[model samples]
Structures are given as structure tokens and as C-alpha cells.
Target chain A: MKNKTILLASRPNGVPTQENFAFEVQDVPALQEGHVLLKSLYVSVDPYMRGRMSDAASYVAPYTVGEPITGGIVAEVIDSRNPQFPKGTVVMDRLPWQQYIVHDGSGLSKISPDIAPLSYHLGILGMPGLTAYFGLLHIGDPKPGETVVVSGAAGAVGTVVGQIAKLKGCRVVGVAGSDDKIAYLKEALGFDEAINYKTVGDLKEAMAQACPDGVDVYFDNVGGEISDAVYLKLNKFARIAICGQIAYYNATSAPTGMRVEPILLKKSALMKGFIVSDFAQNFNTAAKDLVTWLKEGKLQYQETISEGFENIPQAFLGLFSGENTGKQLVKVADREG
Target chain B: MKNKTILLASRPNGVPTQENFAFEVQDVPALQEGHVLLKSLYVSVDPYMRGRMSDAASYVAPYTVGEPITGGIVAEVIDSRNPQFPKGTVVMDRLPWQQYIVHDGSGLSKISPDIAPLSYHLGILGMPGLTAYFGLLHIGDPKPGETVVVSGAAGAVGTVVGQIAKLKGCRVVGVAGSDDKIAYLKEALGFDEAINYKTVGDLKEAMAQACPDGVDVYFDNVGGEISDAVYLKLNKFARIAICGQIAYYNATSAPTGMRVEPILLKKSALMKGFIVSDFAQNFNTAAKDLVTWLKEGKLQYQETISEGFENIPQAFLGLFSGENTGKQLVKVADREG
Candidate 1:
């Protein structure tokens, strides 16, 4: 069988571009014992993928030049020598941006379509889901009547975070880049208030007006001026969960903003930075809770999926431009039964 | 009796000077029922006092103009209407910088002279000591064989923090502005490593050399470039206790530095800013442990006494210049029996 893969042709100095990627066509290797053959069905293009494209030190290892870019992928088992992953099994694996992958079944996790759609595993039932789950519940520790303000509210993690805070009986406020996202967060996601940061004359004033009571927990996904304004209105003993700094992800030089030490000291605030994998040990518990919420309709999710194997790079790049309204995914091919 | 008091004459824009304080002579009021007359002995001069001198938002309320400067004072009971505090009884009180004060015994805490020196209550046995204890044990949570770095290592709180981390069986590194402070931290406070930030050509390189194993727990009393260097070496899951930001205490304009969100996210680190009062519920427990350590000869403390009530402003101003090695106190008068 033939396979097409996207390779990292060059490292990006800042924002990644199509010039940084190259295409390669190769033959899919025959599955050995304990191995499985996967036909890519859906590929996840996440904001965090931007971190792996650079050579800088990060939580995960950087993708080297000439290697295929790998991330979360939902695939169908075409062939299996492993008993655990039989033919026609739908699974989630950290696979390369490829049409087909021959895996040793090491990191392959079997997915049940009965739980939700197969594509949901790459989103609300997957990494993005677990990120919001642990970051909000464990780190945020939102209480009833407390106010939760989340950045990137229209995105996958932010949408879930705002809703989770709402379910916890909190006053939920969201900050996004566009007016449509702001409307979606308040109208569709049931957020108590939403602010379009780009349209607001003064973000601090808007945040103050939205949160009559100061922010108790700030779920920061898009760090920059938006976060700077949020810090100003944080209540005493506020908890700030630093999930992503996507605003500075594309900066060529060092990023500078309002110094937070004085604000943090005055408020006695707790700012913690973490990736979803940091809570790997508790993934099962979090995943179970997420699945239950989705089943009960307590949690809602949306995805902006681009079509074809070749658009994976574009889908990943679109994240910086705020082009996608939820989880951004690339549909590679149909699942083979 | 005539009493001399130091008042906040004017708010400081940046670093406070002698002109910011005003001296006044007032008639001492007769002690009412349940009140006692206190003769000030020793007054503490702390970096946090700098914050109170400025009319800015802080953990504590700003000192209004013409109000007497109040802080930790070691005083002797001169006369008592309240039988609970008899003459010659030594106590620690949040008293103004005055030669005499009549107290109603509301917030006054009696100190046992046998535990350590009477002046020690304003240092290792008082707020700074409690700050080092809880901020380290509760927030930093240093474990055995881990690397703990403390900035402002020769200051009152920083000295105690390094010693406490040592008792916890961790390798402790200290950073200070002067060579003498660095030497005192290693020789007197038992810190395993000491870095003179002023003398070091490259702070990041020096920190890398000193903390070859990487920093596990960081107790930051001084924030700025020193903290920036330490942030670079934080290990995964590192905890930073932000006790004080003395480095930016005197800045006239807004302080700016490298954004920490990216580094913190990559390391999965936790940074918490706290005042000693945040752990008030646990102060007694921490104080008991601190007193025990002092009695056991496991803890050592040194004080730089600036003699006379008139020298209180000078003592406070000296904090910015790094003049004092350990606890800086102004001796107001001789202990009266």
C-alpha cells in the first residue's frame, strides 16, 4: 500500500509556513507481530503543534528536519497482528500526518463509536477535552458563585472550560478575538458574558464591566494583552491556569508585556503553567468524567475540520489567525471497515 | 509625658527618603481601663514597608499622610491598667514608630525572652520567620535531595528560608547583591551555594553552574533579572514561592521583563505570590516549629541594629542599599523595668 506523509523540511523561526513543510510518498510496511496497520481517518491540527515545530526547549521533544510531523490522529485498523487491535478497530494514536501508518500498537488506544462520533476522540473526547477537564477542575477549583473568565472561548478547550464553570454554578465570562465568537460563547455556550477583545476599546474596562465581582479563576489559553487585562481585575487568592500562550507562539523576538509580579503579590494569586499531558496519571478519571458530561449533554463541542491529507499544514496554521471556531481537524480519508 | 512619633509626611513616587517622614512631639494619653503604656525598644525595618510608603494597591493598605508609621515593634510594658500585662513584661506589637505608645492590648503578643533575644521576635520569631516557614513548607514544598534556590538570601526572610530548606535535607543556593551577603549566606546560614549577582558576569551562567541539577524549589524574595535567571533553570514541576519582589519595589514606572508564561508552561511549574498573612491560620504551628529550631541550636540569626529612635527612617532607607546583612532593626530606647 502507498502512503503520503508531511515532513518538516525546515524549522520555523516563529510562525510556521508551507515553506517549512515537504511532502513525501512511500510504501507502507507490512505489519509484523504485535503490530497493526492504520488507515488515517481524521488528523488533529492543534495550537500546541506550533511548539513542536521549533527547536526551542519545550515540554515535548522538537520535531527534527526530515521527520514526519506527528500529533493526535483517529484511524481505522486495516490489518492487525496484535490481538488487542483487531481488523476494523477504531483507535486513537499519536501518529504522523500520513495517509497510512504501520504501528506497533504501543500507544494505540481503542475508541468506541457508541461513546460519541469517531472524530470526537480527536477533540472533546480527546486531548483538548482532557486539557480543559484537569486544568479547570484540579487547578482552577471553581466554586459556586465564583467568576470564571476564559480566553479563546470559541476554541475547543475554552468552550468546554466556560461551560464547565457554568455547570459548577459559576458566573462564566469569555474573551475572544471576533464578535461572532463572542456571540457564540454567550448565546450558544451559555456564558454569562463574552467580550470581543479586538473590538473592545479598552479590554480592562470591558472586563471590569462584565465581571462586577472580580475574577476568581482565569483560564488563560491565549496569553498577551488579553491576559494582561485579566490580571488587573483578579480577586484576592485568584487561580490562573496557564494552558497556552498562543499569542506569543508566533513572535520572532522575545515577547514583553505588563509585569505580573506586583499584581500577583497584591492579589496573593496563584499562576500555574501546565500542558494536558502533565495530568497524564489522572487521564482515565478525567476522560471518564468528560465522556459522562458529553453523554448527558452537559458538555457541548464544535469542530472546524478541513478536508484532505494535504491541508493538515493549513489547518494547523489557521489556528494563529483564529480561522477555526472550535477544534481544528483535517479529514484524511474515510474509515475502512 | 511627651512622646516623639515618626509619621508618613508624604507618599514616595519611587524610593522613600528622609523628607518623606516627619517627626512630631505629642502628649501621651493616660492609660484607660484594660490599656497599658508601652515603651518602644526595637522596631523592624522591612522591604515590604516600602510598599506601604507608596499610595498603590498592595496586600496591605497604604499608609496615609500624617499617620504614624506602624510595624512590628518590640516594647516593654511601662505601666498597666490591664493586670494581664504587668510592668516589665516584654511583648511584640504592631505599634507606631514612637518612643511611647498606650495600647489596649488588642493585637499585642507577649514574647518570652528565654526563647531567644527579645528583639528576635521582630525577626526570626516574628513575621519574617513565619513567612519563611509557611512559604517554604506549604508553597515551595522542598523535598530531600532536591535543589532549592532562595533570592535575597541574606535578608531577614531569605536567611530563614535557606536555613529551613537545609533542615528539609535539600541543597540550598543563595543569591544576594553583595559579596559579604553571599559569604554570610554560605558561611553563617549554611547555604550550600551562594551567588553574588552584582559580581557575577553572567547570572544565567552562574546559576547554571551553581544549580547543575536544576532548581526544584525557588523561594523568591527578590524578583527581576535574578528571578528571570532562576526561571530558566526550573525543573519540571518546580514550585516558586513569591514572598517579596524587592527588586522592583522602587521602580517609578511600570516594570517589564521577559514573559514567564511560555517557560512556566514548558516546565509545568507553579508560581504563587503570597504575604505571610495568607498562612495566618497556620502561624502558631509554624511559630512553634521555629521556636523549637531556635532552642535546639539548629537555627542561627543575626541582626544589624541602628541605634536610637531618630534613626528609624535611616534604617528603613538602608534596606534599598543592601546595607544590612540579616534582620535590620532600630533600637529606640533601653529596656525599662
Candidate 2:
């Protein structure tokens, strides 16, 4: 058997191109003691990956050039050398983008395939799901009847954030790049109001019209002009959860925007930036709540799955252009591969 | 008896000038059943007053044109009709800038002069002191051995914030404009390091050198380039307490600076803007702690008191020019009146 791995070819200047990634084909090594030979099923492509590609100091270490890029991946244990991991067991772990990998199973969690679709683990039941869960609930703390305005509201985490805010009885307003996403968020996802930022000539005015009561909680995913507009409408004691800055990820130069401290001071507001791992201790509780919501059909999720392992780079790049409406994942192989 | 009252003559275009204030002389009215005739002892002039000079929406109501500008004041009750407030009682209240006024002792808190100087109620034991206490202890939450950087370090709130952070066993670095203020912070207040921002060629490098450990708690009072420099040195899970933005309080145009969301997100940090009143429920506890510290000689405060009531406007204008150190106030009259 052979394994195919994708390596970080070079650091990106701004937006990553295909040249930044390199593919390698090699023979799959035999599993060592207490190890399992896994076959990749689904690989997640997220906006946060862009941050890791840079050498700047961040929560996660930068991806080293000429090293395999690692992220959340769902895999099947095709061959196991330890009793802990039997063959045919499906698991999810942060793994490198590869056709097959041999792992010691140190961090792999056995995921039952019966609860939801197998791909759902990489989307609604995985990192993106938890990102939305904690960032919105723990940080944003949306109160019922309060207005929640989420930027990049059609993306993976944003979709879940809007849903969760709605579940908390908040008036949800979504800001996305496309009209299709706006319609989907309003009609399918039940968003109280949706603004297509690309078409909205005056985003501040659009946001004002949507959130008449003023924004109380802001779940920021795409930070830039959209967030600047949202900052203007923050009510007294507003809470802002800074989840992602996808809009400025590709900027070659340092990004500058309106000064926020004055606005925050005037409104006596709070803005916090956090990652899902920060709330790792409460993952079980969040997962249980998410699963309960999923089982009860009170929560819905969408995935933009691209086929073929070779198309992973394209799927990741698509995120910058707002090509995906929900969780963007690439299907590398079938479960029985 | 006659009263000299200062009114907001006109809204300032940029930095307020003495021309914006109007003085009117009138007879002091007799106290009503629930009112007290108070003689102003000391009137505080803080940077936050600039926010009220304009009609912009803020945490507090804007100072109405042609109306008295109200702020923290130490007064003596000369004649009291209310049993709650007797003659010779010294009290602290948010009162209008005036020499004498008849007020309904609604918000007055009797402050004993036996504990400290009567003006201490307007400085270390009052609004600025409570501001530093809550903004640092509650929001900043500086842990032992953590690095705390306070901007506008020699001012009323910044001075107290630094002392408190030191009491919490953290390394405190102060950023101020004048070398005199810097010397006072290091020598008098015992700050670990102090930076004279006006003379410092490279503020960011100076901060990096002063705070060898990256800043963990930022008590931001001056919110322009000084804060922009501090934002770059934030460590993981850093907490920024936005107390005041005196630097940009008089900006002719809307201020814009480097975007902070990406930096906050990368560092998994928190930045909150608040006034002292946000933590009103815990004021008594904070006051008790402050008083204890003062009694124990663990805390010391400096006052920049301009003599005579006529110098009130000059004292306030001097704040922008960095003329005063510690709490800036004007002496209106003696305690006995």
C-alpha cells in the first residue's frame, strides 16, 4: 500500500496559492506496537488554517515549510497492532492531510458512525461546531430578546453560531458575502435578518435596519469593514466574541481600521478573542448539548464537501472567496478504502 | 450669600478652550426640606470630562449646553435641612462645578475627614481610586509575576492601577509623558519600570525593554499610539482594561489605528472598555481594600491641586498638555467655608 501526504511548500506572502503546497507519494509503513494504520475519510479546510501558515506568533504554532500540514481529519483504523484500537474502528483526530497514516492513537477519539453522517464529525460535530458553541455561548453570552449579529454568518462556524444564538432566543442577524448565502441563512437557517455584505452599499445602514434594537452580542468571524459597521451599533454592555479574522488573513501589510477602544468605552462593551481548545475542559458538556440538539432536530448543519483528495488545496482556497456556505471539507476516500 | 456657577458655554470643536466656559453669579437659594447647602471644597477635573463636552452618546449623559458640568466633588455641608446630613458634615458627590449650591442630598456619601485629607475623597479614595481597583482587579485580574503595563501612568486612575497591580505581586510598568511623572512613578510609587513616552524615540521598543515579560494586564488610560504599542506586546490570555482614552478625547476627526481583533485573537486575549460605575455593586469592598492599603502604608497617592476656583478651567485644560501629575483638582474654598 502507498500513502500520499501534502506538505507546506512555502510560507504564503498574503493569500496562499497552490504553489505553497506540495504532494508526496510514499509506501505506507507497517504499524508499530500500540499503533494503528488509518485511512483518511474526510479532511477539514478552515479559515484558521491560514493563520497557522504564517510564522507570526499565534495561539497555534506556525506550519513549518517542507513539513506535512496537520489538521482535523476523520479516519478508519484499517489495521491495528494494539487491543485498544481494533481494526474497522472509526476515529477522529487532528491528523496530517494524507491518504493513509500510521498513528499511535494518543489523541484519536473513537466516534460512533450511527449518530449522524460520518462527514458531520468534521463539520457540525467537530472543531467548527465546538468553535461556535464556546465562542457564542461562553464568550458572547447572548440573552433572549437580545440582538446577535454574526459576520461571515454563512461559513462553518458562523452557521453554527447563528443557529445557537437563535436557540438562545436571540434575534439573529447574519452578514455574508453572497445573496445565495443570505437567502439560505434567512429561509433555511431561520436567521431573523440576513445582509449580503457584497451587495449592501452601506453596510452600516444595512446593519442598522436589521438590528433596530442595537447589537448586544457580536460573534465576529470575518473581521474588517463588516465588524467596523457592527461596532457602531453595539448596545450598552455589548459582548463581542472575536472568533476569526478571515478578511485580513491574506493582507500583505498590517491591517488598520477604526479605533475600537473609544466605542467600547462609550458602550462599556467587552470583546474577547478565544479558540475552542481554551474550553477543552467543558467539551463533553458542549458535545452532549450539541448531540441532543441534533437528535431532537432542533439544530441543522450544512457542509460543502468537495470530492477527491487531490482537490483539497482548491477546497481550502475556496474559503477565502466565500465559495462554501457551511463547513468546507474534502472527501479523500470511502470508509472501507 | 452669592454663588459662582460654571456652565458649558459651547461645545468644543477639538481641544476645549477656556472660551467654552461661562461663569454666572447668583444668590445662594435656601435649602429645601430634603436639601443641603453645600460649599465646594475641592472639584475634580478628569479626562473623561472631555467626553461630556461633546453631544456624543456615552455611558453618561452629555453635558447639556449652557448647563453646569457635573463631576466628582468634595463639599462641606454648611446648612442642612435633611436629618441624614447635618451641619459641618463633609461629603462627596458628583456635583456641578460651582462654589456653592443647594442640593437634595440624594447621592451624597458622608466622607470622614479624620481618615485622610478631605480632597482624598475626590482622588485616591473616590472615583479614580475605585476605577483603578475594579478595572485592574476585576477586569485585568493580574496574577502574581505577571507583567502589567499602565498607560497615562502618572494620572489619577493610572497611578492607583499601578500600585494595586504591584500589591497583587505583579511587575508594573508605567507609561507617561513627562520625565517628572516617570520619576515619581518609579521612585515614589515603586513601579518596576517607567517610560517617558514623549521623550522615548521608539515607544514599542521601550515597552519591550521595560516589560521583559510580555504584557499580561494592560490598564489603558491613554488610547492612541501608546496603546497601539502596548497591543503588540500582549502575551497569551492577556487582559486589557480600558479605563480612559485621554489621548484621543480631543481628536478633531474620528480616530483610526491598527486593528486589534486579529492581535487579540492570535493571543487569545481579552479587551474590555468600562467606567468605574460598571462595578458599582462592589464599590464598598473596593473602598474597604483601598482604605486598608492606605492605612498600612502599602499605597501612597499624589495630588496636583491648582489653588482657587477660577483656575478650574486651566487645571482641566492642562490635563491634555500633561501639566499635572496624579489626581488633578482645583481648591474652591476651605472646609469651613
Candidate 3:
């Protein structure tokens, strides 16, 4: 039996293209001792993966040419060589962009199908959930009766940050790329206000109108005018968690410019940055809390699924274009529903 | 008796000048009810005063035209109308740049003559001392053996920051304008290393050599390229207390373009801006600890006394020229000493 796979053919200078990735089918190798055959059900396509595709220095190394692109996945153990696991056990793990894989279950987490839709392991209940959870709670430290503003509010992580801010008794405002996304941010996520960056005539005025008391906590996912606008409205002792800067990711020229120093001085605020991977050791505790929140319906999450393993790279590329309104993921195979 | 006085005549566009002040000779006013006639001894000249001169809006209100420029002072009550303060009592308080002041003791903090020299109140045991205290301990929380860097290290606040960092068991590096100031900072403050920014040929390489184990805590006083160079050497989770930006005080045009997003993304660090005034509420506790340290000889301080109340405006202007090494103060009058 053979499985379809996607490999990094080349590293793109700027925005990635289809030419940079090559699709191929290869026969599945026999499982060794303590190795389990994983049939990938869902493959995650995240923004951080872009940094891993280039050879430039980052927290993690880039994907080598002619190698499979690896990331988060929800897979099912069809054939097992390990004594601990039998056949047909479902799990969430980090693996390559392929339909099947043989790997150890050490880092793989068991996912109960009765609790959640298996695909959520690729998004809200996954790393993005923890990103918003720890970033806002630990770094942003939003207080009750305070105003909290989040950039990239329609994205997986940003969406969770705003909702969590609301749960913490904060007035939540969201910034998104499109009108529909903005509406969903407010109506679906319970954000107090939503800003459509595309149609907003003046960001500063819009932000001022939305956050009258000034922002007490700013969870920054999109770093550009959105971050700068929220920065101007920070109250005294405000805290900002810098999650990501998607705006300058694909730029071939120098990065964008903004005068942000006066904001800190004016408000006596703090700006801290971190990645979810930094808290990898505490993922178990965060997962338990996240699962409870999801089951209780206190937390809302959305997944934009693209069907078929052949369309995995296309789904990945769509992230930069703002094509996915929620967690962008690809479904490779069904898990016996 | 007639005495010299310098008052804030007007606010400046950027760097304040003599034209922005009014110098005059007036008879010392008579004491009123519950007020003491103080013979001004030492008046502090601080960088934050320049910020107070601007009306563009900040954490504190701008100084009004034709009013006494208010800051830290050490004075002697030659004539007293209040029973609480007897005649010939020495006090540390907020007074104007005048030979004498007759006013209620609203913000006055009395200083015993047995304590260190009265001028120390304007520098080490006063606002600057409290500023360096909280800015380092609370914001720039350094662990023992960590590398800490302080800019403007020979200045009033910067000197204390370096010394306090040393007491905290960190490898301290100070960045000053001249070799003399650097030597004073290293030798007197027990700074592990001192870098004269003006003579450094390559800032990045120099920082790398001085701080082989990247900077863990940065007490920033001068912001600009020096700040940019320091940002390059910050370790993961570094903490920066943006105390002052003496470098940008004279910026007549827009700041030079540069991006520091790498510090945020790569290091996962925090940068916080603070005013000495913001930490005013905590001054009592900070000063208590500071006074004890000073008494025990664990903490040290220096002053650059520019002579005469007539030089008050020029003394303030000299801050931009780096004329004063440590705490810049002006003697309004010598009470028959």
C-alpha cells in the first residue's frame, strides 16, 4: 500500500508558490518495534510554518529541500508494532504532510472522539488554544472592568484571545481583515466590538471610539497599524503580549515602520512576546483546561477545513491571503464516523 | 534681602533654551500662616523636566508659563510660621529655582542634618534614587549572575541603577558618554564593565564583547542606536525598564528608521517605559530601603553641582550636552556657610 505525500521542492524568496512543493506517492514502510502506523486524518497549516520553510534563522530550523513538510496532525493508528497500543487508536501528533506515517507514540496525545470533533486537535483545542490561553492570562494579565484589544481577531489564536478576555470580565475589541470576519468576531465570539481593517476609514479614530477607557491589555497577533492603533489607546500600566506579526512575513523588502516608543512612555505599559512552543512542557495542564472549556461551551472555536490530502499545500498558502476565517486545516482521511 | 530667581517663562518646541526661562532678583517673601521661609540650598535638574515643559500631553501635566519650575530640593527653614517646622530646620522638598521660598509644607520631606550631605537628597536619596530603585528591582528584575546593562550609567539615576544591579549580584555593564564618566561608573559604582559609547568604533561588536552572555536586564536611559545595539544583545526573556531617552530629547525631526521586531520575536523579552513620578506612591518604601543602604555604605552617589541659581536654566540645558556627570544640581544660595 502507498500513501500520498507533499515535499519541499525549493525555498521561495518571498511568497511561496506551488513550484516550491512537489507531490508524490510512496509505498508505506513496514513498522519497526515500538513504532505505530499513523493514518493522518487532519493536517495543520499554521503561520509559523512559513518561517520553517526558509533557511533564515528562526526558533526552529527550516524544512530541508526534498523533505516532507512536518507540522501538527490528528492521526489514527491503523497498524501498531508497540505492545502498549492496539490497532485503531486515535491520536493527535506532530508529523509530516502525508496520508500515512510510522512513528513513536511518546509525544502523541490520545484524543477521545466523544469529547470533541477530532479536527479541533489541529486548531482551537490545540497549540493555538494554548497560545491564546497562556499569552493573555500570563503576559497580558487582563483585569476585570478593563478594556482588552486583540489584533488578527478572526484568526485561530486571536479569536480565542478576545473570547478569553471577555471571560475574564474585560471589554473585548477585535481587529480583522474583512467585514464578515469582523461580524463573526463580535456575533460569534462575544467580543464587545469588531473592526474591519479593510474598510476602516481611520484606524486611530475607530480604535478610540471602540476603546473609550483605553486598552488595559493588548494581545497583539497582527503587528502593523493594528498594533500601533491599539498601542495609542493603552491606559496606564497596560500589558501587551506580542504573539505574531503576519503583515511583514512575506515582504521581500525591509519591514514596515511605526513610531511606538511614545506609547510605552505615555502609558507606562509593558510589551512582552512569546510563542506557544515556549510553554510546551505545560501543554498537558493547558489541554485539560481547554478541553473543559470546549465541552462546557464557554469557549467557541471554528475550523475552516479544506478536503483532500492533495489540497494540503493550497490550504497552507490560503492562510496568507486571509482565505480561512478560522483554524486552517486539511482533512486527509475520515476517522470511522 | 534680594536673592536671584529663575522661573519658567515659556515652554519650548524641543530642546529648552535660556529664552524659555526668566531670571530676576526679588526680595525674599515674608512667611505666612503654617508656612516656612526656606533658604534654597540645592535644586535638582532632571531630564524629565524637559518632558514637563512640553504641552503635547503626557502622564503629568506640562509646566505652565511663568510658574516656578518644580522638582527635588534641599533647603533650610530660616524663618518658620508653622509650629511643626522650627527655625533652622533642614528639609528636603519640592521648591523652585529661587534663593528662598515662603510656602506651606505640602510636599516637603524633612531631612536630618546627621544624614549624608543635604545635596544627596536631590540625587541618591530623592526622586532619582527612588526611580532607579523601582525601575531596576520591579521592572528590570535581574537574577543573580545574570548580565545587566545600564545606559547613561554615570547620570544620577543610571549610577544608582548600575550600583543596585551590582548589589543584586549581576554582572553590570554601563554605557556612558565619556571615558571619565565610564571610569567613574565602573570604579565607584562597582560596575563590572563600562563602555564609552562615544569612543566605541563598532557598537554591536563592542556590546557582544562586553556582554558575552547577552543582556538579561536593560535599564535604558538613552534611546536610539545605543538602544538598538543593546536590543541586539538581549537574552531570551530579557527585561527592559525604559527610564529615559536622553538621546531622543533633541530630535528636531522624525526618529531615524529602524525595526526592532527581531527582539520581540527572537528573544521573547519585555520592554516597559516608566516615569519617576509614576513610582511616587512607592517612594516611601523605596526610600526607606535606599536610606538604609546609603547609611550602611552599600549604596553610593555623586552630584555635579553647577554653581548659582542664575545657572538653573543653563544647568537644565546642559543635560542635553552631557555636561554634568551624575545628578545635576544648582546652588540657589549658600546660607552663610
Candidate 4:
């Protein structure tokens, strides 16, 4: 069978461009024993994908030149040689920007449509969901009545973090780029307060007014100036879980790194960095809990889906501009999410 | 009777000078009921005193000019109207630095000489001892067979940290100044390894050699290049307890604007600053344990005694140059170890 694929052509210096990615027409080889054939149902385009495009060492392996870019995707198994995965079954696998994939069923996970949207697994009930789950609960450790300040508050991870903090009895405050996202963050996602960082003149004062008691747990997904300002107002013995630095990830060399020793010294605070891969052992527990949260309507998700394999690059680029509220995904074939 | 006292004359710039201190003799007035006339026997010279000399804010209150400096001291009650503390009952008190203090018996803990030297209550059995106890156990939280690196390892707190870590089954590595101090750290303090930072060209390389598995717990008394280098070698989830930054205490301003943000991001480490005052509630338990350890010969202590109350300023200034080993103390009158 014929397949369409998007290959990483080069590593970009700053924001990735079309020049760094190339489209390709390839053959889908016959599946061997205990294998299945997958037709791409939903292609997940995420901000974390930007890290995989670079050669720098990170939590996940970087994509090499000429290799297909891979991310979470839901697919329909058209043919199967494995007893566990049957024909016409819907499954989730690390599918690249490809039309079809022949897999040995090793990395594929079966999914139930009755659970939620197939695309939601690419978001609220999938990796992004689990990322927010463990990152907030394990690292944030939000106590009842404590204040939680989350950067990237309108994004996939941030949205979940705010809601989870609320569930845990914390006053949830979010920082985002646009007013619309902020509105959605506060109104839709049940956040206590949302600050449009782009519109705010004095972020420190604004954050202070919102969080009068000071932040006890800071869920930092977007690092840089926003994180810097939050670092100053941290309460004594505050816990900061460093999930990602999407804001600073694109810097060519380094940012004008401010001094953080004062934070540790004055407040006796703790700052920790982690990737979800470290918690792979408990991925099931995290994913199951996330799914339960979504099915119960306690968790909400939003995705900006770009149509066709041709617009995958644009969908990936939307992440840098904060154009997507939750997860950004690319739709390849007929599938209702 | 006439009593002499040393007062904080002015806030210090960089390294403190004699000009920052004022020595004056005041006439001793008659004590009232429930009051005692006590003579200061030995005064402790500690790095934390530098913070008190600065008018700037800190965890502890800064000392004001024209006010007598107060810290750990061993005193002998000359005359007691309180009836609680009799004459010649050696005790520890947080009184103004003077040859004689005429005040009510408050915040004074009577010391038993049968336990150890009276001077040790000002060193191993007092605030420094508790600081090491809590900072290492609760903050640093070292585990069995883990590599522990302690800066200023021959100093009062550092010596106790090494001995305690040794008892905890950790491989204690000492970083100190001079060959003699290094020898003392290894042979006397029971540190598994000692690195003379003054002679080592590259502290990071030396640390790597000493702790091949990487540093687990770092008890930092100095916060300069050596501490920064040790930070680079921190293993995953390492804990650093910032006891005192004696290295930068003498600077006119703060640090020469060197960014210390990497300590948080790169290592995913925890750096916590602390003052012994925060652990006042645990004073009794810590004192009993330390006193027992000393009597059982599990712990050892050394005092660099600079004779006379007149040399208190000199003794404090010497801390910046690493001139003293173990605890630095000044004998104001007839005092015995």
C-alpha cells in the first residue's frame, strides 16, 4: 500500500520552518507475523514536538534528519496478524505524520471509543493528560487552600493543571498570552483567576494581587520572564515543579538568566525538573485516572485541528504563537473526535 | 563595678573592620529582685554574626548600631536574686557581649559540666550543633552509602556534619582550606575523603574524583566557586543545605552579579537556606543527642580560642580568611574547655 510521510529535513536554529520538514510518498510494506496495519486516524501536533526536532539532549530522543516525525495518534487497524489486536479495531500508537503504518503491535495500545473522543486520547486522556496528572499531583503536591500559579495556563498541560489544583482545593491562578484563552481558562476550565500576560503591564503586581497569600505551589510549564516574575513572589517553602521551558527552549544560546539563589536562600524553597518518561512505570495509573477525570466532565480539553497531511507543519508552528488552547492535532482521514 | 561591652558601631562594607565596633565601659548598677549579675565567660564568633552587622534584611534581624551584639555565650552567674540560678552555675545565654551583664534570668539554659566542656555548649551543644543536626537530617536528608560533600568541612558546623554523616553510613567528603585542615577533616572528623580546595586547580574535577557516583547531599557553608563546582556534580535529586555564605559576607554589595539559576534547572536539585533559630523547638532533643554523642566519643570538637574580649572583632574577621578550625571562640575571662 502507498503511504504519505513527513520527514525532518534539518534542525532549525530558532522556530522550526517548512525548510526543516519535508513531505514524502512512501510504500507501506506488508506486516510480518504478529503485526497489524494502521491507517492514520488522528495525528497529534504538540509543543513538545519542537524539542524532538532539535539535536540537543532532552527528556525524549530528538528526531534525526530523514526520519519521520512521531507523536501520539489514534489509528484503525485494517489488517492484523496479532491475536491481541483484531482487524477494524481502534488503537493508539506513536504514529508519525504518515498515511499508514505497519507495526509489530509492540508499542500500540488498544483504545475504547466509549471512553471519550479518539482525539481526546491525543489530549486530555492521553500523554498530555498524564503529563498534567503526575506533574501536578506528584510534584506540585497542592495542599487544600494553598494557591497554585501555573504558567502556560491555557495550553494543554496548563489547562489540566489549573482544574486539578481546583479539585485538590487550591486557588488556581493561570498565566496565558491572549485574552480569549484567559477567558476560557477562568470561565470554561474553572480556574479561580487568569492573567493575560501579554496585556498586563506589571506582572509582578498583578500576580501579587491575584495571589495575595503568595504561591505555595507553582506549576511552571512555560519558563522565562513569566517564571522569573513568579519566582520573586514565592511563599516560604514553596514547591516549584519545572515541567518544560517552551518559552526559553528556542533561545539560540542562553537567556539573561537571573539569580535564583536568593529564592532558595530567603524562602527555603525547592525547585525540581522532570519529564513524564521518568514515571513510565506508573503510566497506566496516570492515564486511567486522566480518562476517568475526562469521562466525568471534571477535565475539559480543547484542540486546534489542522486538516490534511500537508498542513502538519503549520499545526506544529501554532504551538509557538499560543494559537492552540489545549492540544494541537492534525487530522489525516475520516474519524469523528 | 565597671563592665565593658562591645557594640555594633556601624554597618560593615565588604570585610568588617574594627571601626564597625565600639567598645565602651559602663558602670554596673545594682540588680533588683528576680535579677542576676552574670559575667560572660566565653563569647562565640560565628559567620552568622556578619549578617547581623548588615542593616539589610535577612532571616534573622540585623543588628543596629549603638546596640550590643548578641549570640551564643557561656556565662557564670556572679550574684542571683532570682534564686533559680545560683552563683557559679555555668549556663548558656543569649545576652549582650560584655564582661558582665546585669539582667533577669531569661532564655538561659543551665549547663551540666559532667556532660562535657562548658565551652562546647557554645559550640557543639548549642546553635551550631542544632544547625548541623537539622540541616543535614531534615534538609540534606542523606541516605546510606550515598556520597556527601561538605564545604568548610573543618569549621564548627562542617565538622559536626562530617561526623554525623559518617554515623549515617554516608561517604563524607570534606572540602576545606589548607593541608592541615584537610588532614584534620580526614583523620579527626572521620571524613572518608578530604580535598584542599585552595590547592585544587579545578574543584569540579576533584569532586568528580572524590565522589565518582556524584554528590548526594551538600552541606554548603561557603557559596562561591567551590559550592558552584560541587553543584555541577550533584547527582539526580541531590539536596543542598545553604548554612552560611561566609565567602560572600565580606563583599561590599551582593555577589558580583553572577547568575546562580543553573543550580535549580540543570541539576533538578533542592537548595534550602536556613538559620538555626528556625529549629529552636528541637533544641532539647538535638542537645541531648549531641551531648550523648560527645560523651560516647562518637563526636569530637575543636576550638580555636583567641584570648581576651578585646580580640573578639579580630576573631570574627579571621573567619573570612579561614583562619580557624572547628568552632571559633573568644575567652573573655577564666574559662576552661
Count of backbone clashes, every candidate in sequence:
0, 0, 0, 1
Q: Record all residue pairs in model 4 with backbone atoms less than 3 Å apart, i.e. clashing.
A: B14-B250
Tell me the tens digit of each residue's lDDT in model 4 across B232-265.
6777678888887777777665353333443344
Worst 10 residues of 2 chain A by lDDT: A328-337
Per-residue lDDT over A146-253 for candidate 4, one digit per residue giving the tens place of the 0 to 100 score? 999999988888888898898899999999999999899988988988999999999888988899888999988877678777877788778888777787667676
Superior candidate under TM-score, 2 versus 4 = 2
lDDT of 4 at A298: 86
* Native contacts retained by candidate 2: 0.89
What tens digits encode model 1's per-residue C-alpha lDDT throughout B132-170? 998899999999999999999999999999999999999
lDDT against the true structure, per candidate, is: 0.91, 0.92, 0.85, 0.83
**CAPRI rating of model 2:** high
Off by over 4 Å in 3: A252-256, A280-285, B252-256, B280-282
What TM-score is obtained for chain B in each of the predicted models? 0.98, 0.98, 0.94, 0.96
True contacts kept of 4: 0.34
DockQ of 4: 0.39
The order by descending TM-score is 1, 2, 3, 4
Q: List the residue pairs that clash in candidate 2.
A: none
Q: In model 1, where do residues sit more than 4 Å from their true spots?
A: none
Model 4 spans with C-alpha error above 4 angstroms: A49-57, A93-97, A252-256, A279-296, B190-192, B247-268, B277-285, B335-337
